[model samples]
Target: MSSNNAIVLKKYIDPTEGYPKIGEHFGLEERPFNLEATKVDEEHPLLLRNIYTSIDPYIRIRMQNPKYKSYLPSLGINQVIPNLTLAEVVKSAVPEHKTGSHVIFMSGWEEYTLVPKQAMGMVQSVNNPYNLPLMTFVGALGMPSQTAYIGLKHIGQPKAGETIYVSAASGAVGQVVGQLAKAMGLYVVGSAGSDEKIAHLKEIGYDAVFNYKKESVHEALPRVCPKGIDIYFENVGGETLDAVLLNANFHARIIFCGCISQYNNPNPYGLKNYSQILTKSIKVEGFIVMNLMPLYQEEYFREMPKLIAEGKLKYKYDVYMGLGSIPEGFLAVLQGNNFGKALSKIADE
Candidate 1:
C-alpha cells in the first residue's frame, strides 16, 4: 500500500577486517515503491510481498569485498541484500495468475519484490498439499535440505553401516544431512555449539552429539565416533576439519559445506594435518547449493515435504518477526547465536 523498507549494505566488508559491529554494516532504507501508484505489466513485473527469507552463513560470503573472485556476487554498497524467499503474489500481469498465489523466489531482503516473467526458472509456485508451515519452504524443504541431499549423495557417496560425523549438526543444513544419514542406516554422530542444540540433534536421530564449545572437537570426535568417521558432513571448518581428519577412517569422504567458524576471517585457520587426506585416501570435495539445485531441486520438493509433513523428517529454524528484525537476526546467525536456521518474517499470511 505504501513505500517499502529494504535492508541495504552500507559498506563492503573487507576480509582483512573483523566481523561487522551491530548496525554498522547494514542499514534499512525506505524506497519510493508504492504498489498503489505503480503500473503493472510484463516489463514492470509482478509485485511479490515477501513472507520469509533464508538467512545462512553463505550470506556472509556475499558481504565480503571482491578482493578475490567468488561464485556469488558480493553485495554492493547501498544495494538490498538478496536471499531465497517465500512470497505471495500481491500483483501480477499474467492472465492465469491470481493475486495471493504463493511462489518461492529470490527476493531483495525487503518487504516486496518485482520478479519478472523471465525469472520463472528461478521461481516456483508453492505446492503445499500437506498443510505444512511456509517457512519450511525457506528452511528445511528449501536450500538447507537441498544442500544436504545433493552434497551427501554426490560428494559423500555414503554406504550403509558406515559412521558419519557432522559438524554444526543442529543447524539447518546439518540437521537434514544427519537425519538422512540415519535413514540410510549409517551411525550418525554430530557436534553442536550448545547443549540445547546437541539435545535436539539426538532427538532427531543423531546417535551421538556433543557440544564442541565445551569439549574440543579433537577430543569429542574420537569419543563419540570411535568407529571413525566414514562420511564427514563438514560445516564448521578450522580445527573441526583437522579433528575429522584425525579421526576419519581410511577412504573417508568429506563433503565440504560452509565453514561458519571461519566466515569472518581474512586468513582462515590452516589445517595442520594436510597429509591425512593422502595417507587415508580421503575424498574431500566442496559444493555450492546454487550450482546443484537445478539438478536436485525437483527430487527435493517431491520427497522431502511428504517426509516432513508425515513427521518422518525433523527440521529446525528460527524466524525473527517483521522486516525490522532482519539486521539483528542476520547478525545472530553470523555469530552462531541462533539455535537454528535464522530467517526474517515479513508477511506470512
Candidate 2:
C-alpha cells in the first residue's frame, strides 16, 4: 500500500578504533518503495519483505575504509549495510519476473529491496520449497555452502585419508566444509574460539576439535595432525593460519576463505610463518564464490538439495525474528557472537 521502513547505516565501523564505531545507528529516510503503481523502470522489480535478512562475517569487510586493494571496497559512509535476504515479488516491471515469486539477493538490510535485472544473478528463485527450508537459500543451500564447496574442491583439493583442518569450524561455512570433508572420507579436524563451538564440531563429525582461544594453535595442530596437514580450509587467519603453515605437509593446499580473525583489526598482525609457504612448497590461494559460478551452478543446485533430502548434509540456523532487529543482529554477527547461519525471520508465511 505505502512505503516500507528500512534499516540504514549512518556511519562505517572500525571495530578496534573505538566503541563508537561498532554500535552507532542513524536513520536515513522513510521513503516509498512501490514500483508498478509508480512509473516502473524496465529493469527493477518491486519486492516484498518475505524474509528480512541474515548477518554474515564477510559483511564486516565492507564496514571499514579500504586499506589494501580489496576485491570489493568497504561500505560507503551512511549506506544501507547489505546482506543476503529472501524476498517475494509483490509487483514487477520486468516481464521475466512475476508477483509471488520468492528469490534471494544481496540487496537489502532493510525490509524490501528493488532489485535490478542486471543484478539478478545475486537473486535466485526458491522453486523447491516443498523439499527445503526457504531461509536455507541464504544459508546452507546458498552462498556460504557454495563458498565452501568451491574453496574445498578447487583450492583445498582434499583427498581421502589426508588431514584437513578448518578454523572457525562451527560457523556457517566451516560447518558445511567439515561435513563435506567427512562425507568425502577425509580426516577432518577443526578449531573454534569457544568450548561450545568445539563440541558442535565434534557432533558434526570432526575427528579432532580444539578451542583455539584456550589452546595454542602451534601445539594443538601438531598434536592432531601427526603426519602434517594435507589441506587447510582457512577461515580465521591470524595465528591459526600461521600454525597451519608451519606444520603443513609438503605440497599441501590452503584455501583462503575468510580472515575473520583479522577483519576487525585496527592494526594488522604479521604472520610469523609465511616463509613456511615457500619452504614446504605449499599452494595457497584466495577465492570468492562468484569466481566459481560455473562449477557452483552445477554442484550447488544439484548436489546440495539431494544431500539434504537424503540426510547426508545437515544445516543449522540462528534466527532472530522481526524486521526491526536486523541492525542489532548484523552487529552481533560482525562481533562473532552468532553461530550457524544468522537469520532474521520477518514473516512465517
Candidate 3:
C-alpha cells in the first residue's frame, strides 16, 4: 500500500473576511492510508480511487466555524474536506460491488477512500446507459441536476406560458433549471456574470440572457420578461433577489437554491423589495437538496438521464485537473470564474 494525496484544511476560514487564499487555509499533502486497512470486516469492505470531485459554492459555508451552523455539518480543522466524488472501486470485499465498478459517493478531497458496507447506501452506482461521459454523474446526472429538478418541480412549480428567471444561469444547477423550464414550454431568461457565459446560455436555447456585471438585474428582468417573472429560480441572492422581487408577478414562485453573492460577504446585502412577497402573494422557499433526496431519487434517476439522452437537457463542465487543483477549482467557483458545473479531475477514468 502507498500513501495517498489529499487536500486538508489548514485552518478555519473567516467568511466575513472574504474569499480564501489557496495555501493560507488549505494545503495538499500525502498521508499513509490504504483501503484495506480501514475495513471493519473483511467480508464487505470497499476501496475507492476517486476520479472526479465536485467543487460547489456551498462548501464555503462548511469552512466556517460550527457556531455559524448550517444545514450541513462544518468541516473540522486538519481534516479532509468531503464533497461529492465519482470513484472506481479498486478493491472490494463485497459481492455486489465488484472491482472497477464506478460509484458516486460523499468522499474527501483525497486520491483514495475506504468505506464499510454499512456506509454503502450512500454510494450510488454510476450507470451511464446512454454512454455519456462518466463525469456527467458529477454534474448533470448528479446532485446538481437533482437539485434543479426537485426545486423546479416541487417548489417553483412552473407552468407552460409562464416566464422563468434564473440567476447564476450558467452554473451547475442554474443551467439545468433554465433548460428544464424551456423544455416544459416556459419562457426562460438567465443572468450570468460574463459575456462568455451569457453567450453559452443563449446557444443552449435560453430565451434571453444578460451579462449581469454589465447590466443591472432590475433592468435585465423586465427587458427579457415584460409580463413579469412567474418563476424566479434564485441562485444568487442579495441584489438579484431584490430585482426579482420587483418584477415578480402575482403568486410567483421563488425557489431559493443558493446565495453565492452573500456567502462570503460579512455584511450581506439586504432586500428592499421583500414587501412584494406579501403584496403579490408570492411563494419564497429555501431548500437544501439533501432533504428531498429520498422522495425524488427514483424519479430523478429515471427522468434526468432520459432527458439528457433525448437532447432536451444539456450541461457544461468547468474541469480542473488533479487533486492538487481542488483549491483552485473551489475558489474559481466561489468567484464565478468557472462556467457551468465546477469539478476537479482527480484521476483518469
Candidate 4:
C-alpha cells in the first residue's frame, strides 16, 4: 500500500482576522496507508499520486465555520485540506481505468488519494493533445481562466477600442483578463505591487502597468489611462477600487472578482468613492465563477487552450517543492508575495 502524506488543518482560524501566518493552523502528517489484503473488486477505488496543488487566497475563505460559511465547503480540522489538484493515476482497481493516466479533482494536499467509484463525478479527465504544461489545466485554462472570460465577455459586455484597467493585474485571474481584453481589441492597463510585476504585465500585452506601491492608484490612473477606463476588473478593492470609481468613464463596467487586499485586514475596508459609481452611472456586479462555469464550460475549454497554443496567451506559476513548503507557499500566495500562481509539487510524474 502507498503511504499518504497529508496537509491537515489543525483548526478553523481565519488567518486574515487575527493570525498573520496561516502555517500555525496547518500541519503535515503521514496518514493511514494500510490497505485490505485484496481490496480490488468489480467496482473499485482509484489511487492517484498528487502532482501539483494550487494555492490561492480563496483558500483562506474556507477557513471558517457556519458563522462565516462560503459557497464552498469548509475545511475539516484535523483532516486533509483539499483544493484544486492535478494528479496521475498510480493504481486502478476498476476495469475501465487505465493506470498512469492523468486527471484532476478537488483532492487533498497529500501524496496520494484513494478515490472510490462513487466519487468519480468530481474528477475530470484531462485532454493533453497539445501537450502544453499540465499546470496550465489548473491555472490558465481552469477556474482562473473561466473567471476572467465570464467577467469580460458576459458581465463587462466589453467592446473594442475602449480602455480597461485591472487591479492586482499580476495575479492568476487578473493576468488572464488583461491578455484576453488585449486580444479582444481593448486597450488594457493594469497595476501590480512591484516594478518586476509591472514589467511582466507589460510583457503579457498590458498597454500600461504601474507599480501601485510606488505611486498611488489615484495619481497614476490619469497618466496611464488618459482615455478613461471603460471597464474596471476589480481585484484589490479598498483604495484601488475607490480610485477606479473616481477615474472611470460614465457607464463604466466593474467586475468585482475579489478584494484580496481586504481579505486579511481585521478592520473593515471602507470606501470613500462609491458615490462616483452612482454619479458616473457605473455598473458594478459581483459574481462567483463556479456559478457561470456551466453556461460557458465548452467555450472556455476550447478558447483558452487555443489561445495558449497560438501564443495569444501566457500564464505563470511559482512552484514550491515538497509537503513542508505547503504552509509557507500557501501563506505567500495569500499575502500577494508570489509572482504568479502558487503550486506545491509533492512528487515527480
Candidate 5:
C-alpha cells in the first residue's frame, strides 16, 4: 500500500455567501489506497495518475448543498473533489483498458485515482489525428468548444453580416463563441475585464472589444455595435446582460451560457430591461451543453478540430502547475484572476 495525496471537500459552501477562501472549504490530505487489497471479482478497475485537470465555474455550483441541486450531483463533504481530468492508466484489471494508455475521465483532485469499471464508458481515449496538445481535450476541444458550437448554431442561429455581442469574451467558452460567430460572417464585439484581454480579443479578430471594468457596457455597446446586436452570447449575467437587453435588435437571440458575474453574489441583480425581450420578440434560451451532446458531439468533434488546424479558431489557457495549485487556480477563475481557460497541470505530458 502507498500513500495517496488528494484535495478533499472540507465543507459544504453557501452560495449566498459568495466565493470561498483557500482552506476554508477545501484542503489536501494523504491516505492509504491499496488497489490490490480492495479488489472485488465482480468489479473492474484502473489506477490512474492524473496529468491535467480542469477548473471550471460549474464546479462551484456543485459545492453547495444538495437542496440546491444542479444537472450534476453535489460534492460530498470530506471526500475527494472530482474534476474532469486527463490521466495515464498505470494499472488496470479490465481487458479493454490497457496499461500505459492515456484516458480522459472524471477523477478526483489527487495525484492518483482508482476508477471503477462502471465509469469506463465515460472514459475517452485521447488517440486522434488532430495532433493537438493533450491538455486541449479538457479545454478547447472538450466542453468549452462543444458549448460554443451548440449554443451559437442551435440557439443563437447567427446570420451573415449580423452583429453578435459576447460577454466575458476572454473565457474558454466565450472566446470560442466569438470565433465561431465570426467564421459564420457575423460581426463580433467582446467585453473582457482588462486591457490585456481586450487586446487579445482584437488579435484573434473580434471586430471590436472593450474593458467592462473601465467602460460602462451600456455606453460602449451603442458605439461599437451601432446597428444593435442580433445575437448576445450571455456569459457574465448581471449588469452586462441588462445592457445587452436594452440594445438588442428585433428578433434578436440571446443564448444564456453562464452567469459568472452573479455566481458568487448573495443577491444576484435582476434584469431591469427584460421587457425588451417581449417588445423585440427576442428568443432567450438557457441551456446546458450536456443536454445537446447526443445531437452535436459528432459534429463538434469533426468541425472544431478542422477549424483549429486551419487557424480559423484560436484558444488560450491560463495553466497553473502542480496538484497543490488546484485551489488557487479554482479561486482565480471565479475571481476573474485568470486571463483564459483555467487549468492545473499536475504532471508533464
Candidate 6:
C-alpha cells in the first residue's frame, strides 16, 4: 500500500512577509503526516479514507500561529493541513469505536488518518441516518450547524418577536442561523455577497435579504431593519460589522462566529466601531465551536435534529468530488465562490 499523497503547508503565510506557498509530497516512510500508532494510547484511532472533508473559514485561522486560541493549535510547520472529515473506521482499539463504523473527527487533508478515537463521534445515533446525505454530517448537521447552535444560545439568545440580522446569510453558519431564527419567531434579515444567494435566503424564509456587494451595508441594513436589529449574527466583519453596529438597537447581542473579511490579510484589520459595544449596551463575544462541543453532546444534538426533521430548520452545502480537488475547492471557499458549506467527496457508493 502507498501513502505518499497529502497536502502539506510549506510555510507561514505572512502577507507582510509574502504569498502562501505549498510544499512537496513525501512517502509513508517519511511519515510527513506524523501518524503515531501505539496501543494503550487508547484515544487515537486509525481512520480509513475519508468519505468527506470540510473547507471552512475557521481552517484558515489555524494556519496562523498559536496566538489565536480559536482552534486546537496551528498545524505544525511542514505538517499535513488539518481539517474536519467524515471517515469510516478501518480499525480501532478503543472500546467505544467499532471497525466499519462511520465517524467525524479532526484529520488531515488526505485519504486516511489516525485521529484520536476520543475525537470521533458516532453519527448513526442521529436517526434515519441512511435517508440523509453523508456530507450533511460535515455541513448543516455538522461543525457549521454546531457553530450556529452555540452562536445563537450564547450570543444571540434570540427571543420571540425580535429582529435579527445575519451577515453572509447564505453560507453554512448563516443559513442555519437564519432558519433557526425564523423558527424561533424572530424576523430574520440577511446580507449576502451575491444576488443569487440573497434569493436563496428568501426561499429559505428569511424575512429580508440584501446583496452586500451590490448595496452598501450602511445603506441596505437600515432599510431592512428600520426598527433596529436586536441580534446580529456576524460572519463577515470589517465594513459590514461597522454598519451593523450603527444599526443595532439598544441592548443588542452580537455573535461573532467569524471574520471572513479579514482572514486572507497579512495584517488583520481592527474594528473601528468597537466603542459602540459600550454605547449600545451590546454584548459582543467570539467563539470557536470546539469549546462548545461538550455542550452540543449534552444538549444541542438531541434538540437540533428534531427541528430539522420537523422542517423548522434547513441547511445547504457545496460539494466537490475527489480528494485531489480539495485545494482548489478550499481556495474557492476562501474566495467566497461557494454559496454554502464547501466540502469534497472522497468516497462513493
Clash totals, every prediction:
0, 1, 0, 0, 0, 2
Give me the candidate number with maximum TM-score.
Answer: 1
Candidate 2: global Cα-lDDT? Answer: 0.76
> Would you list the clashing residue pairs of candidate 6?
43-117, 44-116
Clashing pairs in model 3? none
Best by lDDT: 3
TM-score of 3: 0.95
Instruction: Report clash pairs, candidate 1.
Output: none
TM-score of 4: 0.94
lDDT of 3 by residue, 247-269 (tens): 99999999999989988898989
Give candidate 2's TM-score.
Answer: 0.90
Q: lDDT score, residue 134, model 2? A: 74
Alpha carbon lDDT at 56, candidate 4: 70
TM-score of 1: 0.96
RMSD of each: 1.5, 2.6, 1.8, 2.0, 1.7, 3.9
lDDT for every model?
A: 0.84, 0.76, 0.87, 0.83, 0.86, 0.74
> Against the true structure, candidate 1 has what lDDT?
0.84
lDDT of 4 by residue, 1-349 (tens): 7567788887777634654354567777776676444354435478777898877777777776547767787777777888788898777775555778888887868887778778877888889777878888777776777899999899999999999999989988888999989989999999998898888998999998899989999899999999999999998788898889888999999999998887777775789988998899999999999898989888878777888887788888888899778888887876778887778887886
- Best-first order by lDDT: 3, 5, 1, 4, 2, 6
Judged by whole-model lDDT over C-alpha atoms, candidate 5 comes out at: 0.86
Candidate number with the higher lDDT (1 or 3): 3
Residue 118 displacement (Å), model 1: 4.3
Task: Give each model a TM-score.
Answer: 0.96, 0.90, 0.95, 0.94, 0.95, 0.86
